[model samples]
Target: MSMGRARSVVLIGMEGHLIEVEADIGQSLPAFVLLGLPDAALRESQDRIRSAAKNTGIELPRRRLTINLFPASLPKSGSSLDLSILVAAWAAEAHVAGTAKVVFLAELGLDGRLRPVKGVLPAVRAAAQAGAETVVVAAENAQEAALVRGVEVLAAEHALQVASYFRAPGAVEVPADPAQEIQRVTPGSPHAEPSAGGEAAKDLADVRGQAEARFALELAAAGGHHMLLMGAPGAGKTMLAERLPSILPPLNEEESMAVTAISSISSGAASVTRLQRRRPFEAPHHSATAPSLLGGGSRIPGPGAVTRAHCGVLFLDEAPEFPRSVLDSLRQPLETGRITLHRSAGQVTYPARFQLVMASNPCLCGLNVGSGTQCSCTVAQRRNYLYRLSGPLLDRIDLQVQVERPHSAALALQQPGESSAEVARRVAQARAVQTERLAAFGLSLNAEVPMNLLSEQLRLPSKEVRALDAALDRAQLSLRGYVRVLRLAWTISDLFLKDHPEADEIDAAMVLRQSAGVRT
Candidate 1:
């Protein structure tokens, strides 16, 4: 028996494993065998590796090569393990040794060039977590990997280049970041539109003639509350939803990384860079499936639109038209700030801490009490239309505002309101105040205040506390609803520069909570 050894790596979901690739060479037959519970994508890596080996001028022995991926029962998926497997098979067959120092991961192109693989950022992080010494990956993913500290990383363009690095460590030069050569980027947008840099982002200023709706939106952003907008078809409800993210707070470094990870798990490495700069704006069609909204399928469970919109906005247009079950699925996440999908294989938890911005017509006919249109649907039809939105779902929503169609005079007379940047500054101020006020309790935003801690941390005077007690008793608010109102009251006070939400703050917030909201 002649023994040859080679080393290689495989990237699992947001993690990297140093795989033991052992190749046992025998003279019985020239057949190749791979013993590992690899998924279909990985099963096909043999051809890619073989072609890349031939193109890179690596000779394969004309004898049986039995390759084993150690941690034998662990499920392996994706072609990312191809390079590691190839190297391991070759090393064992060629009797190569002392490769344990280098960690290698990449997909091999037929031309022998090293192509970028998915989850490279997470994979690199996983390696760092495991105290890996040195890591080599595709040149394209080097910049992302370099973000982590404590590990020496080398990126190369082709398989031979990486192999050469292993053969002579510290000899191969790591490429510098070519960001200047890359296009000038707008930080919030990943994909470049021809007019992206020049065009303006959708702003709150674009929404017009809906003062109450605007106030509701501000409160929602200020307190991280969910909002529901009821209006006629042409009332700019959708436009308002689109602009919510712009007025909200920007993501911090840690939040940005978490957001990018969710995106990465969705579309792989390319996803990591895209759709992460800005707060996610996901508007699923009314006809989406439960899995499409909540996440599930054959492989590992992917993040749903709600999870993607974490630390962002989930805009559900035509909200009442969505399947009741899909809409109801939101209740758990809305309260818990995360969703867990339990499959027989395992449970996948994703952050669902997002502001839900839902817009729906007041009635099935798209108009029940607004301008430029008359009510056509029967009373039952209108009631049934609104009925589709179950009470449990509606109750979870923190703020519900009715948006009326623009007045003929208002539409004709006004210019666009203040720009998004102008409003974002004010919103940022309110958020800062919340951060300061809650700093003592290790909290920032008002919405994060749980009821158990509210009386202690946000302790109000007896008069104000009694008013809240009366409101809760009269309104029959759930434990969740009571906390949401307190959060909203706090936001309203901050908006008006009040130190604490006094009786007036409570009153102003009560108007929004009243059963007799202005329907028109």
Candidate 2:
């Protein structure tokens, strides 16, 4: 009889837990018993281990082998543990040394090949945090695993190679297959590289009209504020939304790490070799469901659109067409900047601090605004269509701008408005001012400043806030709306290089918040 142990990691959303694989080999009838709260996929690794051993020419004595994942209460899933289980069993049977301190993270192919697994970055990071000295992963995942500082990473292609590392008896090198040498594209890889022209190609210059909407977009990007655009079909609303990322600032080091980790886990680690420096931009279709928008699974919840857009923009074009439940699912994340999904197995929270931008037509026919001569919808239909955007959700959006169709004279000139690079400069400058002003409170954006801070230490003179006070007294804006308008006024002041928001800034904020002619 002999015993051996190895280590692995199981990721529950972005959080990873270290798992110990303990194998006991006893002289008894040939049987393999895996004792851990493994899910369906993990329970199937036993057959894979047996097949890999046979294909690799490794001999296993016909005896009772029981493997127990310590802390048997934690539910384990996925094939990531396959390599560790087989290695632990081999060490017990062959008396191989030096596996207890090494963490193995990979799936085993039926042909004894090591396959890349998802979440390798977080898994390796967790192992390093758990004091594991070394980590063994497939060659495809080696680059990603090496990203974690202070951990030794080993690369291997097949189970034989891993066995050889431990000097296991009967282990031999497997000849490489020429046919398998072709480059394999990783899942979630970017479809195309950014244009050589960079942000200039996606520049706001391409959007020729709707100057009011352009100003709102700049304000939204500058302050990290949520915005709503209401206009006709051809008013450049979608174009404006698509170009928002161009004007936004790149993520800082901490935000980049958080975004890269989320991307690696939600997608696959293979594609994310380095941190994602640019802010993410996610635009889910109108037909998306609540679970898809909010992140869900049968067992373990995954990151949703909001989480994927952390420190970036989440644009919902044709917002009214989305199911009300899905649109409402964004409310919690909008306020808290994070989302916690509870599942039967466990609950995991993901960062969801994203700037929201929603574009919608004024009514069902989408032509009720401006001339309204081509409109076909009735008053009730128009009201109901707008009502689909719940009151609370609408209140959460700070800037609501009406996008008017550009005049023919403006279109004839073909002169581009302010370029994205120019606006981005102003946005970055405004952001720097906010970061310095709010540094004492641990905030970097005007939108994230709390209401108490705005009302107390940063309170404005009564004359400057009189318009907002009257609007509040008349119940035209809720308390939340009142606070948001205050935040927006501050952003306007920041953009104009003012020390404080004057009365004109407050009035302009109210105009943008109400969206002038658009009905909320």
- The top-ranked prediction according to lDDT is 2
Per-model root-mean-square deviation over C-alphas: 5.5, 4.2
- Candidates in order have lDDT scores of 0.70, 0.85
lDDT of each residue in 1-520, candidate 2, tens digit only = 3888899999988888999999998899999899989888998999999899788777556889899997799899999999999889888876356788789999999989999999888898888898988888887886677667678778788877777667645644434443444222222234212212223337898888677889999999999888999999898899999999999987777887788788888886466666677788899999998878888887888899999999989999999999998898899999899999998777899899999999999998899876788899998998899999998898778888889888998898899888988999999999989998999999999988888999898899999999899999999877887898899999999998899998899998988988734443
Clashing pairs in model 2, backbone N/Cα/C closer than 3 A:
none
How well does candidate 2 score on lDDT at residue 323?
91
Once fitted onto the true fold, the runs of candidate 1 whose alpha carbons sit more than 4 angstroms away are 1-18, 26-28, 93-98, 168-200, 268-275, 370-373, 455-457, 465-483, 514-520
TM-score winner? 2
Model 2 scores worst on lDDT over the 10 consecutive residues at 191-200
lDDT of 1 by residue, 387-448 (tens): 88888887767677777778887778687776778778888888889888888888887767
Give TM per candidate: 0.85, 0.91
